[model samples]
Target: MTATEFIKKVFFFEVLQGLALTFKHMVSPAVTRQYPTEKREPVPGSRGLHALVRDTETGKEKCVGCGLCAAMCPSQCIHIYTSEGEDHKKVVDRYEIEVLRCVFCALCVEACPFGAVALSEVFEYSGYTREEFYYTKEMLLENWDKNMAGEKGRIYFEKFWRPKTVDFGAPALVKTEERKTV
Candidate 1:
């Protein structure tokens, strides 16, 4: 062994360094939030539970029963049943979501053309039975009313859920080719 290695072994420099780190941490302030009494705000676009948006004018669900959300879901947790109405328009008979099976990917939100479905900020939902997690049309609408209504829902869609398309209300910046002089 070299002389430096011998000195380190005899003085236990590595052990002292480890203890110093431990002691430093012991004196440091606790970073953990008391989860029950104190809650941290969820970041924008953070996916949690699912909700169906309601049309403000009609006060009914905004879902047109297009089934795009179901088609886009990777987990296949969304289900929608639609039939012909008396006026020959499509009517949604049922809308169900297996919340337990949902992967919270938020693809359903992006696939919706009408901005009907949204992932709410509520992550505290818990239930003992599987049936409680099964959300129906009414339940989803209620979820929106409870957790994502008004300004909060609007901000969520505007900041996170809305798809960025070419016609998304922004002025296009087109570059023109310059003519070359001979």
Candidate 2:
């Protein structure tokens, strides 16, 4: 081999090539998320807020009150109770989630064999009361209505489809019922 080739092997062109790539990327737009204020919604199938999705068509809980989710909870945040349904099927009487303790690890949702449990896209859910945070079956269902308003809104397209701009741009104002009324 040539002495120049031997010198390059000893000096390492690979390190220089890697540094070039790093410098090239240093000027590019960043994808890092600024949490809480500038949030990114999870794509479908991402594990987030664990919930037992009801059969909207039947207006019933998808869960059969099966104990699999409870059994699988790493943090022991889940509790289940069963009752007889109108169709004589096992029904979810209570599906209590202790939010303070839940790690949001999503094991309970994965453990559910019925495809009943789903992790919602919800990323903001802070509450003042312990009672407010300790979600019941009713609360999670209600959360779908409360949080999904933006996802289903007509203005979603206008907001979402816009090209990303400067990082320091002013934050969008929150929409309220009072604002709409006026």
Pick the lDDT winner. Answer: 1
- Please report, in order, the local distance difference test score of every candidate based on alpha carbons: 0.85, 0.65
For model 2, the superposed segments whose C-alpha errors exceed 4 Å read 1-37, 85-88, 145-182
lDDT of 2 by residue, 21-121 (tens): 99989989898988868876565444456555655567766677869888999889888888887878887788888877888777775566655655566
Residues 1-182 of candidate 1: C-alpha lDDT, one tens digit per residue: 99999999999989999999999999999999999799998765679899999888999998889999999999999999999998899898999999999999889999988889999888999989999999999999999999999988876776555644313355333333311110
Report how far residue 34 has shifted in candidate 1, in Å.
1.9
Steric clashes per prediction: 0, 0
> Candidates' TM-scores?
0.86, 0.56
